[model samples]
Target: MPHKYHESQVRRTDAVEPSEEEKQTQEKPAQKEQSEEEKQMREKRRERTERGREVGAEEADAGEKT
Candidate 1:
């Protein structure tokens, strides 16, 4: 016996619909604003670190001369 592969058998006749929860999830906005705030906070932290390093180097130089 030969196997039959038909287009009608593979195709779906009914339209697939999203459930209520799925619809709500699709509608909800992700935390893009929160992510931007976090990025800004990280940049500020890096700037502070660089400044502290420069100050530490200056202090060490002053101490060496004393």
Candidate 2:
């Protein structure tokens, strides 16, 4: 018997994925607090919710009056 290495076995490389340095770089950029745009969106959502509640309240009042 003799040791035989095939072309496929000899031509193999490291797994195609992120390296440790790449992983480290990605990990360094931590998610910060809510951005200004996010804050504005949240404020707009709150305003819309408040408006919906007020509209519902007014509709109830109108129903009682009718």
Which candidate wins on TM-score?
1
When summed lDDT is taken over every stretch of 10 residues in candidate 2, the lowest stretch is 28-37
Q: Candidate 1, residues 1-66: lDDT per residue as tens digits?
A: 855755665454322566687876776566566678889999987876676687886775575579
Per-model TM-score, in order, reads: 0.44, 0.35
Number of backbone-clashing residue pairs for each candidate, in the order shown: 0, 0
lDDT of 2 by residue, 1-66 (tens): 855876676556343567798886777645333366678899987876676687886775575579
Indicate the residue-level lDDT of 54 in model 2: 78
Per-residue lDDT, model 1, residue 21, is: 78
Q: Which runs of model 2 end up more than 4 angstroms from their true locations?
A: 1-34, 57-66
lDDT of all predictions: 0.69, 0.67
lDDT of 2 at 29: 43
